[model samples]
Each structure stands twice: as structure tokens, then as C-alpha cells.
Target: MRELKYLNKYLFKYKWHFLLGTIFVIISNIFQIIPAMLVRDAINYVVDNLNIYQSLGQSATQQKFFTVVAFGIMVFAGLIVLMAFLRGVFLYFVRQTLIVMSRLIEYDLKNEIFEHYQSLPLSFYRRNNTGDLMNRISEDVSRVRMYLGPAIMYGLTLITLFMMLIPFMFHKSATLSWYALSPMPFLALSIFYVNNIVERRSEKIQEHQSRLSTFVQEAFSGIRVLKSFNREAQSMEKFDRELDDYKKQSLKLTKIQSMFYPVIMALIGVSTILTVYAGSMEVINGNLKLGVIAEFIMYVNILTWPVTSLGWTSSLVQRAEASQKRINEFLKTKTNIVSEKDLVREINGKVEFKNVTFIYPDSGIKALKDISFTIAPGESLAIIGTTGSGKSTVSSLVSRLYDTRGGEVLIDDLPIADYNLTSLRKQIGYVPQDVFLFSDTVANNIAFGTVDSDQSKIEQAAKDADVYHNIMEFAAGFETRVGERGITLSGGQKQRVSIARAIVREPKILILDDALSAVDTKTENNILNSMKRIMRGRTTIIISHRVSSAKLANKIIVLVDGSIVEQGTHESLIGREGVYKDLYEKQVLQEAEEKTS
Candidate 1:
């Protein structure tokens, strides 16, 4: 059986409900046992005398034999009806309490995991798949629920039946009772073996399931690219390979489960035959009373159900234990980023990188090394670099998405470690290169995290992002759902909506990390102009390779091999004729050559 120690906190929360449910089960279990004892008593009464009236200690001359038999029938009927009613009541509440408790556990566990995931650095998501994380919170949590709910009540029922049965068996016939229970140890050992196999098979199935989900998610999210590139048949073939592995795993689990029933039935068949045959011989030899034999047979029936259930419960408990280990492992994983106790919320957007060095979590080569720079408030600085030149790494530090291994990132001359994450992030407005939006209205998406954003404020942000007129043209206007990841909207629309979200935050610093990469020059210029109009007092840091965007910044910082190669306005950088100047000349020549062609 799984030790649910980690679940103690939640169990304590719902202790009262479990207590009431347990009370009901106990009452119902004891009441059900009364019918078995009553049957034995009635049989004993019949055995006392040949005359039906005198059998139960009634008057000998009395002609009330018919009435006595009828009264016995009535009493037996009442006991049966009462037992049925109580059992029904008990099962209902047991299910009720367990269901409620399971949902609560699921809610807390998933939410807590989400909170933990939020606290973790970006490197965690880079190492793990989004689909796998979703499955762990959704499917894995549900698996835990199965054990806590229906499985618990079944286990409780088995235990209660065992307690009531042993005493009754001892009283019936001590020698026969001992003989009847002699095979229990063998049964238990076999169950353990069966459970071990089931657990191993179940683990493989879960692994396959996660792999399948990941494949489907990636393919579906990139369906447009796949279709445009004519990779449908190729994608399908890859998906089938993953699905085939999943099918094999499922089949293996079923095969292991299939073996359990036969083994259980064989043992139970042996026990039942021994019980009946042994009791019959004793009666024939005049060593045991017939009433005792009858009662023993009835008790054997009661034991049969629990005996069969042991096999099933063994499989369930093993699966639950495996799931428990998996959940514990997830819970134990520590976040890469650590928050300090002295963190405050007093940043004024003066970002400083002091001899900072950072490497990806799984990499030996440093992505950024010996980087040092400072940007004052209200200054617009541009970062231009080749792919993997640590441009994004520097941009991410401003949001505390990655912690530097050497030196420190400071805001307002204080180390970023000194500022609380929530307060620091609130001061910065960042629109990521990959735009992600939920399936919700444009208004809601724009005003996502703003507490006091009314309709007018939402529209103002939209207008500033250069997406207001476009959103108004949709069939449902601002009420239209964006579809999954904003798939219903065009690429430019998605980018601008994300910008609108950042605009409404009214941040002290604005970061456009390739945010306008998807749009054409005309649309990009319009969005940039709108942004420039509203960003007078705030520090704007734009990271882009496009010289047009870079030129707009009052100051430009160019990076190469994780170090600043040059820092100046566009005209000054052009005057120096370095890396940035060469790149700018190449892009300008390419555009002129395209126009001539």
C-alpha cells in the first residue's frame, strides 16, 4: 500500500468529512453482519426440535407452527431490507466525501505546482516540455485522485468485512476455521508479485503517454508551417511511430492485468472447495452440528468478495505508489532562481550589468561573459548582435528570467537581487518575440493584468499599439475570441496585441525584444511611431537587428561574442565603420539592389 504522507496537509483540511464517512461505513458494516448471525440463530431454532412451534422454545401443545415460521420470514426480511438501506447510505457518503476530497487535492496540488513553476527560472522550461508539464498537472493529478476516491472505500470495505468475519468463523468451528484460513499467506504473497509487475508496466505506459502528448502538441501548434512546407505525410509518419510505441505499452499493461484474474480465481477456487468439502465430511461423521455447517458456508460467501478484491486492490495500490513517487519527484525539484529576504520594490529603471557572466544551465560555454554597461532612465538604447551573441540573455536579465553566475544586475544602483520579483517585473513592459495570447477578447487580452483598466483605457492602449482599427473590423469587434495562441489573428496583429498589453501596464521601462519582427516596414514604422509618442518619460530598450529600429534609439549598444563592440548613435557608429556599420551598409545595399531588380 502507498504511504500518503505527503497528502497529510490536505487530509487534515478535510478531516471532518472523512470522519463522518468513516462513521457511516462502520455502522453499515456492523448492521450488515447482523443478517448472517440471525440466519444462524434461526437455523439453530429449527434444529432444537422436530416440532416447529416447540423448536424455538414455544408451548408444546400450541398450533402456532405456521405463525412462527411466518414471523421468522418477516424478521429475516426486515434484516435484509435494513442491511440494504444502510449499505446504500454508507456507499453514497463514502463516494461523496472521497470525490470532494480528491477534487480539493487536485486543485491545490496543480495550483501549487504552477506557482512553483512560475518561481523557477526560464532554464526549467527550456529543459522540460510544456505538454509534459500539462500532463503532469492534469492526468497525473487525476491518477492520484483515483486512489484517494473509489479505491479508498473499496479498501475500507475489505478491512471491515475481515474484522467481522474472523470472530464469527472461530465460534462456528475452531478447527475448520483454522483450516479455511491456512492458504491466506500464499494468496497474499502471490498478490504482491502481481502488483510488482503491474506497477512496472504502468510506469512504462505513463512514459509513452507523455511522449505522445508532446508530439501532438508540437505538431498541432506548428500545423501552419507543416502544411505550408508540404510536410503533412512526414508529420503523420512521425506521429504514428510515437503512437505505435504508446499502443505497445498499453497492450503490455493489459497483458499483466489479464494474468491477475486467473491466479486469483484459482486460489479462491481451492479455498472454497476445501471449505465445503471439509464441512460436509464433519457433518457426515457426526462431529459437527448441521446448523454450524450451514453457518460456516454462509460466512465463506462473505469472505469470497474480499478475497477476489485483494487481487484488484493489489494492482491499484501498486499503480498509486508509482504515481506517488513521480509526484514527489516533481515537488522536490528546486527552482534555479532564488529570491532574497531583503528584496524591495523601489527600482527607477536605471539598469546596470557589472562584469556579468552567464551560461545556459546545461552548457559549458558561457553565453554572456564579462559584460558591463549602464543605462539611465528616459534613455532609449538598442542592442544589435548576431544570433546567439547573448542579445536575448542581456534582455532577459532585466526581467530576472535568468540569474547571472558572476557579478550582478542592478536597478537604480542596487543589485537586482535586492528587489522583489513581482515589483521589479511590474516596472518593466516586455513584448516577447514569440507572441502568446489566450483564446479571449481583444479588450481582455490588452487589459490582461491591469486592475483598473476600463473600456477607454483598453482602446487607448490598442490605438497606441497601431491595432485599434484592425480589432474594430472583426465580426465581434473587441469581443471576438483570439483562438488558441491568437491563431485566429494574423502574425502582425498578434504582435501588436502583445504590445498593447505592455502599453496598458504603464511601465517605467519598455522592452521590445524583436517584437516588431513579423510586420512589414510600413506597419513596423507606424507601431514604432505610436510607441515613441507615448514613451517620452520612460526608459525604452529596443533589441533589434533592423537598423531602422536601432537608429530610432538615442543610444545604440552593439554586442558581438558576448561583449559590447561599440556604443553610440547610428550616425556616430556609421562614422566609426565597425561591425554595426558594416551590417547596416549590407542591409541598405540589399534593399537598394532589390528595388533595382
Candidate 2:
């Protein structure tokens, strides 16, 4: 219930809609009750007039009386029809305002959650699964919307009907009204008891739904791997097992929810019986008119639908509470990686790491240990290391993807945190080892980072990355669509296209983290030659294990177990008997052996 209070701000945002909807509820109910009163008066008028006409015994006066009675009945019927029509119109307005406002809030809430997801650091994604994150924004929000739209609408209708109808019932006959409403307290108790169980079952159902969604999403994403392993039958078995569990939970909820309407109808039956019995006794005693009994029955019937809806509206509210609690859990999380300063400054790409040490938050492994380095503006530095030697970590720190645990990372002589986060990232073009591409055309993928990139600029970047010829050979040329994660292209082609994406950005700092690993030596050399032109005045850091790529850098550093072992020019490092020289010699032998074979 407390979690539901978060929606109050959204409600306030669309206050006028709610206010108008409330007015409509009141007016519609008024019109609804007026028809019942007219029915009561019409019944009494017919009873009174019948006796007079019979006493006149078919005279001219009796015939005149019959004419007047028919006219009166027609007028009453016309008025009743008009009231019903107006009530329906106001009800339509109620739906337009309240339900439409809920949709608007749903739109705003989803956008807000997605924007927050984008602002969160990379480590947050590592901590949470993609399925759960998606569930919160989609399925969970839909449940909350039920609370916003249908539950609120029905709840308001019930209140308005009760306030208007109950008092009139009492005014007609206190004793009879008491008998008619005697079952209400019992109904209230039943609802209270069922609400708790409904809430618990709803939470379980939501959890299972998220699990099912995650399983399906992962299974589809890795369909190629599943088929290669011939695990389709196994996957189907797992899905069936989960589906059975979900079915059982849903059935339990439905069994309980099914109890609502029967109980409401039974109670309403009891009210009807009591009202008839008491009202008939009053009429027999000449204390009340017989027409009043019909009026009481109509009132009870009018209240019937709203009373029965109590269980449904309560269930909606309980489910919404459960879903909103899940949503708030993520919305409350504050990202640690945020810019301390708002000032935007141009980056000159003088990146420096002073006594920097970093540990991965998700897996508390220290990736960098008191490492120190500096790459002056317009210089090229290549970091060479074996797997898990903190080579990629260096590139991430340069991009400020993660903050250091015990030291400072500076850009242009200012702490990285001082610059605006967006501004800093915009000036750096990074091509990661594991490349990902959206389902879009090849030209669009290359021009992804540059907002104003034309077709010529995209083609130029593709040629510079040595992927132009391959793209031109495609059936659609640069217009060819790369499937999910660029599955339409080969490994080397994907790597080159990613390089083209970075090249098009024309950033001040370019970090290539093993971006050319998938290409052969010939293609690698061609890309390196093209990069030499692009890297002329940019601060570049090339992270790779191959000596052919490392030799192009102005300076080379060898990283071993998160510590710098050697730092010098490529020629100087090769002359030394250290980690760098050993790596270079091994690569040289491997290449020679390949040629001989």
C-alpha cells in the first residue's frame, strides 16, 4: 500500500482529468437514481388511478381518465429513457478522462525507467539479469496500470453508487433498509480475508512470469547454439516444467477469485428476500405503499453490479501493489558512477592514470594494481598482454566506464569526474573486442556514433577500416542489413565494421581493444596502414597480443599479472630480454611455422 503512494505524483500530474472524471461519476449516479424514483411514482399513480376508473364504470369521465393515464405513462417512460441516455454519456466521459490519463502515465513511467537504465553504470548490468530488468519495465508496469485504470474506476463507481443509493433506501423505510443491508458487513469481512491471499499469490505469479520470460529470451538469443548441440527436446522439457508450475499458481488464484461473484450474488439474494418480506409486512399494515416495495427492489438491483465488483477491484489493487513494490526496488537504486561537475569541456586527450587501482564490483577481483601511465596528446601507445592481464581494463578506465578504487584518472589535466560524463564520452571512439551491432543497414552501423554522417562519410570510414570492398560485394551494398549482433556478417567482417563505426566518430581519443583479432595478417596490415592516417593527431591506445599490431605504436608497454613489466619504444622493447621480447619472439615463430605448414 505504501509503495502505491509513489503513483500520487503521477496522479497529481493529471489532476484535471481525475477531477472531471469524479464529477462525471457523481452526475451519472444522480441520473441513475432518478430513474428508480420515477418508476416508484409511476407505479403509485397507476394504482391510485385504477380504483377511480373502476368506480366510474365505463362512463365518458372514465374514458377521459383512461386517456390522461396513458399520456402520463408515456411522459414517465420518455423521461426515464432520457435520464438513462444522459447517464451513459457521462459514463463515456469518465472513461475518456480517467482511463486515458492512465495510459499517459504508463507512457511516462516506461520512458522514465528506460532513461534510468541508460544512466546506470556497466557494473549494474553485470549485477542484474536482462530478463528481470525487462520484466520491471514491461510486465510489472502493466500490472500497475490495472490499478491506475480499471481498479480506480470501479472503486469510484462503487463509492458513488453507495453514497447516493444507500441514503435513499433508508429514507424510504429504515427497518427495510436495515434488513436489505444486513449482509454487507459479512461481505466486507470476506473481502478483507481474501485480499491477503490474493496479494501473496499475485507476487508468486509475477516472479514465475519473469523467470519464464528470461528463459525464453535466452533460449531464442542462443538458438544457434541450442540447435548445434541438438538440445531442442531438452529445452522443451524445461519450458513445460515451468509452464506447469505457472499453471498451478494461476489455478490457485482463480479458485479463490471464483469465490467472489457467487458469494456476492448469494448475499444479494438474501438482501432481496429480506427487503420483500419486510416491505410486504409494512404494506399489509397500511404503513407503506405497495409501490415502495418495487422501488426498494430496483435500488437493490442498481447496487448489485458495484457490490459484486468489489472482489475484482480488490484483486487488481493487490496485484498492483506487488508489482509496484518490484518497480520501486530498482527505481530507488542510485548509480555510483555520476559526474561530479556539470561543466562541459573539450577533451585534448592527454589521459593519465596516477597510482590507479580498480576492482570489479560484481566479482571482487582486482583488475589493476597501483598502475601508473601517461599518454600525451596526439601520441600512440600500445598495451601488450596475455589474457586477464588488465589490458582491456586500461581502455575502460580511459573511457571512465568505471571509477578507480584507490587512485585518480585524469583527462586534460582535470580529474575525469570533473568533466560532464556525456561530454567526455562523446570525444572518445572505442571499438571493443566483443563487438555488437543492431539490426540495421551496414551504412547505418558505420555511422551510428556520428549524428550528421552522410553516405560518403560512411563509405570513407568503411574504406579506412578495410571493410569497404566486402560491404560493396553484398547484394544490397552498404544498405545490407546486419542481423542481431551482426550475425549476417563473418567474424572479420564484423570486426572491421565495428572499426568503421569508431572511425566515423573521428574522436580525439581512439581506443581499439583487440579490434582486429578476427582478421588475417594481410587484412590487419591494410587496416593498420589506414589507421596510421587516422591516428596521426589522435591519442590512440591499441590493446592487442600480436606483435604486428604492437610495433606500429610510438611506445609499447608489457602488462603481466596487472603490473607493468616493460615500457619503451617497440625497437627498444624487442632488444630487451623481458616479457615483451618473449611475446614478440613467440608470435614471430608462430607466424613462420604457419607459412611453412
**Predicted structure with the largest lDDT when compared to the true one:** 2
Off by over 4 Å in 1: 1-4, 46-50, 53-64, 186-266, 284-289, 593-597
| Model 2 stretches with alpha carbons more than 4 Å out | 56-64, 191-210, 247-254
Clashes of 2: 0
TM-score for predicted model 1 compared with the true structure = 0.89
Q: By TM-score, how accurate is candidate 2?
A: 0.93
Against the hidden reference, what TM-scores do the models get? 0.89, 0.93
Candidate 2 positional error at 8, Å: 2.4
**In candidate 1, which residue pairs clash?**
none
C-alpha lDDT (0 to 100) for residue 31 of candidate 1: 67
> What does candidate 1's lDDT look like per residue over 1-597, in tens digits?
434578778878888766776776676677667666667666766665456555556454454765666687678778878877877787777767766777777788888878877777777788787766776777767777777765666677778778777877777677778767766656767766877787778788878887787788888898889999999999999989998998988898898889776877776667767767787788788877666655665666666656656766666655666666777777888875666855766557788889999887766668788888888987788999878788888878888898898989988888787777787887788888889998888889998877888989889999999999999999998899999889899999999999999989888988988888888777888987887886787888898877878977888988888888899889999998699889998888987886688
Note the Cα lDDT for every prediction shown: 0.79, 0.89
